[model samples]
Target: MHRSDSRGVFDALVVGRGAIGATAALGLSRCGLRVAVVAPAQPAPSPLDGPGTWDSRVFAMSPASRALLERLRVWDALDAARVAPVYDMRVYPSGREGAPELHFGAYEACVEALAWIVEGSNLSAALGRALSFAGVEDIDARVEAVDCTAPDHAALTLAGGHVLRSRLVVGADGARSPLRTMLGIAATERDYPQQAVVANFETGLPHRDCAWQWFGEHGILALLPLPGERASMVWSAPQELAGELLGHTPEALAERVAQASWHVLGGLRVLTAAQSFPLRLIRVDRTIATRAVLVGDAAHVVHPLSGQGMNLGFGDVAALLDVVARREPFRDLGDALLLRRYERARREAVAAMRLTTDGLQRLFGDHTGLPLPGLLQPLVGARELGWRFVAGSSWLKRRLMAHAVS
Candidate 1:
């Protein structure tokens, strides 16, 4: 690894090496800026080949997210055999008999795919390669302190006692962002009484490039198609249910999943161990402070029911690039007004996604014992009504499909 020079100031310093952080470094560097990425070095991931070797965690990449990666010349580097395209999506309202089903298709939307299912590691590896090819400096160290009081620039002190200065610092450090804390930004956080269990499976029947989702009394179950006859599962269940599911043996768990999915894909053979993570909604009033900007999970996090968390992070990178690329020549990259423009452009989209996902989680959450307020009791039937509405209206479906692809 090459050590970053402490004497020279950078145009931007990215403080994370995840997909969003690495991509931000590459994008900013491409715009003729001296960029450096700060993070502890990590060992290379094992090759993702051979049968049953698949990542447990994957992301459903929207067309817009794909476009951003393509522009950065990173998408093509991904192993095509591991990527799966979603031609259609079928969503069934809570396991009620005779429940209306809502369907969205790439054909109806007049696009190649509704979205693509990609392994998180696959995306991260490609981004890493692109960053190296782009000549973005990699500071293999942890940030120990931040000083943004400097009028023209911010300084990041590494744990090794080296100080690196930059006009702007990007905090793509993630949900529990230390940089966000150091910058004195406050985030509103709410924890959902649920956890998402994820794993990959080899199905007895082909998924046919379709994504399946079911809302049940216990939780939400989604099966996303993977290459070949395999599929990835993300089951968002209440805390107690998640614990039970996680405790089951691999075979027992597969059987339980098969039963929950009503044997739609026939018998399921577990390809990977199940892992779970808590779900939550995180939002910050402002994404920028002085010479600092927060992107990705550092700025906001939403429920995974919509599978838009990663997409939203990628969207942040796109918006940040646009604002920085189009800024007035006289204004520096970290100019307060320039940063505000970036914030303004992202506010509405982020809020809408947060509201949509969080609202759906609350609406579909187990309400067996809990009583709905008299006036709000209508929601008990709203789920079915909303599904019927979306399913019956072609124009509405098309409108939604367009928004999703964008």
Candidate 2:
């Protein structure tokens, strides 16, 4: 529903063209909104030709995320040979002997796969192609200011002083969103004392489509399945340990990784150089204000331990599309009450995920080296008990798996 001419305003203007923002622009366009995406153009990634060239950054895409991409026609466009399905996941607790281990299987869940391990470059390439095919307008500029005071439409002033008007402005910027600041939104932030070190490897033994995770005193280490006899590792290690890891030679790092993972996939050889990113939790008081809305990391960022950060951002795009599509006929896309409806729909899910990821990080992160006295002993025991309880209960596992897939 576009307003009458002369003003040349778009129905929706999306800022940032990362996966989430790009996907939002496509979704908004499909919803029949005259949409445009504003961001500097990026060079397309070079083709992923071999094991040595695999991108170190990969995401564990949930079933919900898969379906959204499928619906948008971006799924089939991906390089199937590069995508890895996670049929099984084995989670091991701290190095205590006989520590309870949890397992999840696709068969138990009655699904094709628990999740799909996709390289960032692969997904981004597909999105870029889809955007081109869909012919969505692209505004290659950085936003300098936003004017949301207008009742009918919001105006975005670019870096060079050009202005673009849109009924609704969607923020898909990263965790440190400049648009969020321009909109005067406050975010509560907490930094984790660790960094996620990522790299890809060729396993000595076939991964058998299984993902492995170990929660040890050092940190959480996840080895997600990759095509062929390969795997991608996300090791959330303490800051000091991460620095040491980064300092090691590729061969030495591979040796360390093999030993830490108990050689579960046998020996490992480096396929990609190691890279590290700091971890943090970012939460906003609200996702909408006036004619504006936030999506992806701009709205929330959770610990990577659960591997649901990207999925949550996809969930935001899905919910926003649904709400705007079903709005009352007379209501504008940026109507205050209409935007609030989208916020209410996503509030609970976002909070629950933040609590779960943050809570687990705290629960397993203690390395105080102090003796637990009296009453504090049971609290220490709860970690083991919790894992055992979840592993032993089929119903609980199903519930947890069901939530994850959705």
Candidate 3:
């Protein structure tokens, strides 16, 4: 462990170094604040490890998120060849009987592109590089304890017995945040009783820069187009069904997935072994307490079906930075009043997203026979509604997009 004297205390201490934490630290540091980020050492061989290892997980970065990365000067650092533009999105119900299709295109909204499909590791590495260049000190240590004794200052103790003080403490740690737990904040959690099986695969046909989602009896399956002849997939299903998929050999799994997807990609070849993560809805009672605040998964965890998880975290960083940059004279950075501004601004946004995602999960995950017909008509209508929604709400969408980059 390394130690440094607290001559001039840092302006902020950000715990967690995932995409959200790193982005928050970089944002604060770029705004002329002295920021220190604490995280464990980088994973061995990196997280992205195989031909299947080329970041099986990918994010559908809304236009707003793209602009935010651009503002942070990090978007340019990502290899253009690796980034795939999502010019259109196609969502439909699965099966021969009740399936209805909905299409959304950037041309309909008069934008360059609706979103970008990016590998998780590529985005993280780009953000890390930006953080390094912005002079944000990355302390290679785990935080053992955090003490918010004083009103204007919060203190942190690392595993190696190093103590560091800062005006504000931001917990972007993740859903099971140590910092949040240390503050005695408990989360309200509900497991969806489903698992998301993610993988990367090569398709016989080119994706043509379109992302697709098929809502089926099992659950929702999303195929996001990637650079080259590849696509990333998130298949959420019941635990038993997920286990069955997991039990298959790679070649066998590829054949099953190809058939399940109705051969949309023609012959499918699995490039990576299937990986699964249990699905859940996690929301903390309070995101702010005294001198500390929470951001990203540390604040909330939404369903990944909509691909809004990371984007929501980016919203947190953007809002917090705005509040901090506009603090009144003589106001402490960690002052309760100053921190409340962030709380109020983010609470409604987070709540709305939680409700929206939860509602979708519940509506789509129900396999009961009663709501089938009623659900089918609306599912058909949703395709038309989605197109109108995206086209008619340009102003609201622009505001949201702007927040991602701001």
True-vs-predicted CA distance for residue 16, candidate 3, Å:
0.3
Taking every candidate in turn, the Cα RMSD to the unseen true structure, in Å, is 3.0, 3.7, 4.5
CA lDDT scores, all candidates in order: 0.87, 0.87, 0.79
- Candidate 3 per-residue lDDT over residues 1-406, each given as its tens digit: 5364564578999999998899889889988889999887777336553445567778888776777678888899986777898887776666634444556677866678877888878988888889888989999889888888876577888888888889999998888899999988889887877899998889998889988877667788888888888988899887888998899888888888777777888888888678998888898989998689999999999888878889888888888988988988788889898888999998877876776566556555534322223323354335334434533566645543333222
Give per-residue lDDT, candidate 2, residue 354: 83
Q: List the residue pairs that clash in candidate 1.
A: none
Worst 10 residues of 1 by lDDT: 367-376
Steric clash pairs (candidate 2): none
- Candidate 2 Cα errors over 4 Å, as ranges: 1-7, 366-382, 393-396
Give per-model TM-scores: 0.94, 0.94, 0.88
Kindly report which residue stretches of model 1 are placed more than 4 angstroms away from their true locations once superposed: 1-5, 366-382, 386-400
lDDT of 2 by residue, 285-314 (tens): 889987999999999999999799999999
Residue-pair clashes per candidate: 0, 0, 3
Score candidate 3 by TM-score against the native: 0.88
lDDT, residue 275, model 2: 97
